[model samples]
Target: MIYELNKSHFYKVSHLLTGDLVNIEIKGVVQGYQPGWVFVEHIDHPKTAMIWSKAIDGFYFIGDENNTDFNDYINQFISLDIAPRAKDLGLISFEFSGTSLSWDKTLESVFQNRELHRSKQFTYKYKNIINASIAEIELQNGFEMMEVNVFLLEKKLSNLDFVTSMILDWWDSLDDFFVSGVGFCILYKDQIVSCCISSCVTDDAMGSHTVTLNDYRNHGLAKKLIHQFLTYCRDHGFEPNWDCMEENLGSRLLAESCGYTKDSEYILYHFKLY
Candidate 1:
């Protein structure tokens, strides 16, 4: 039988998570620095584990994939306990800590009837930045760009809160976000049109979340914002992290343009709920 681990004991499985250090979401949740759930094969000493983050609708599995009992229990738990309630939470996406044919085979078997969708996710590491021409645009009229802070968020000016909330979905509160988070936004007529921010953060790295308004695309706004964000991270000694679906050509191109080199790739399995 599997057991749910108390948040206090979440650290028990940290060693198993070394394979995905760039996944700040995993670090955040596992450390209880963010919200999530954890389950293990053994309450006293776990050999297998599952962690789920509600904010991102993401699940991560780690350790002992060859454990038949744990595998059987998890398959049932996901199908009967989790799958039925997925709609309430959001569509669930599954990722594993390390590459294991055993785990991969188990995933296919467990989700065979659940319409599992698989895709590749690419992670990028910050290298030397490719400086872009943003000063001319920054000097342009009606374009204002600035760092995001408590004061700026507190002002509640012109859809800033909405965009911040939408992009920083992993953060529970603005207070929590500003504790270590950093972001930059470009505004047109006081309206935030393009922004890039630290979606997840740790002592040495910061994950990225970038968005541009639909009508504001193709104007180099995203590039400018990313360049500024990366510059800030570089100056402050934090490595900027980026992850995107392999199919997202635009996002991949943008990251490459900003000097983020592809570091690793992983698979994500999406399960839909009725």
Candidate 2:
């Protein structure tokens, strides 16, 4: 039977299952950052008895239900059929099987740069260099650092603030460290202009790392910030990665200009609640 989840219940279960490493939490369940995914707990089932599984393209399932049963759930919820697959790089805790997902080269590049591909001992060196570059650019542009903070999903269902909660949920499932990613913002004349966030995934691996705000467009600020972030990731034994919709030409161009290649593309299925 389909069940409705309240925010508090969702948070309680999601935290019980994924811990503080999760990104998307709302009320109580896991939401998607991209499209075509949902993280939910089977309310009637025991938490410890639950099983989590991930398929291709960030698709995940919770509980001991088999693929056929899960497919039934997907069809019922979204009116679509999906096959399950075994665990892959993006799948953190579970395994299933289906067609492999596709990603472009640029997406791959973003993932690589997400982690700086270095060891922990050198992380500060990388961060200092990147931060210094950002500071230098800010000084040159007369921008001021307004805020620098790290977000930690210590509890459950804290992702309602973002547009892509489900994708964030899936990301949290795979990389526990992303729960504490850092966000940096720069302000001009007391108006927030540029901002970026860094992930905990290694640079060589495929992951999401950076995002810049709008209104600060066309200033090469994103490129500079990303470059510094990448250098930081490299020095700290991590790689850097970034991704945007294929239709986002501006982002594609920026990534390309900054040495990111075109990665493969995967269809994102979105289901809106009535």
Candidate 3:
């Protein structure tokens, strides 16, 4: 049987569960989570048993094999083209591989539109890139580049002009991006032209999310802003980790330019309801 946990002990319960910290988005929620649901089996002694759990906009399971009734949970979580809960919940997606065959297979069958994606993950430790910085570009003569605190700006959080994708929407759902996130941008005429920032984070890793105005591409603004962001990470004791679809060559090249090297590939399983 599964049951919801009291909000008071989320931190305690999270510490008790041993699992992957790679998905920094999920890590932040688990570590100092908000009022999201945390359903677990074996309520009486959850830590003593292999557990199955999911938080809002989070991975379905960790620390154990997936439960048998995941389909029922997905059904309760969403319906055909409509969500009865969590407005602004643009999309909920999960990725896994050989280790989570059961949950992977289950979601593939439950969701209607399934897409198999691949991302070449990369990492850059502070030591390897302390001297790395962005070179000036001729087109950037009138632009200003700087970092901004996402947690403090409600306007930016709700800004529709920049929130073009579901991932950006997910960043907005975060109660506070500063909890485990960072951001930087290039402002041209007070509008974001190019930017690079962490959309999700853990204690030691910041998940990379970067963007540039389509019209401003090839100006090298992303590399400039991201290199500075990496310098900030070096000073703060965090490493920037990245993952993008295998076919996104431009993204791959930008990562390489900023001192990141290919590390591994992940099978990202996306299930979207249209």
Best by lDDT: 1
lDDT of 1 by residue, 107-160 (tens): 777566776778888889886433322233353567778887866666646887
TM-score of each: 0.85, 0.44, 0.65
RMSD of every prediction? 3.3, 13.7, 6.0
lDDT of 2 at 210: 44
- Provide the clashing-pair count of each candidate structure: 0, 67, 0
Error at 64, model 1, angstroms: 1.8
**Between candidates 2 and 3, the lDDT winner:** 3
lDDT of 2: 0.36
Clashing pairs in 3: none
lDDT of each: 0.73, 0.36, 0.52
> Which digits, one per residue and each the tens of the lDDT, describe model 3 over residues 6-110?
655445456444443234444545555222445555564453121211222534344344455433454444443123333345444443332244544655555
lDDT per residue as tens, model 2, 189-212: 644455555432321322333444
lDDT of 3 at 47: 35
Poorest lDDT segment (10 consecutive residues) of candidate 3:
47-56
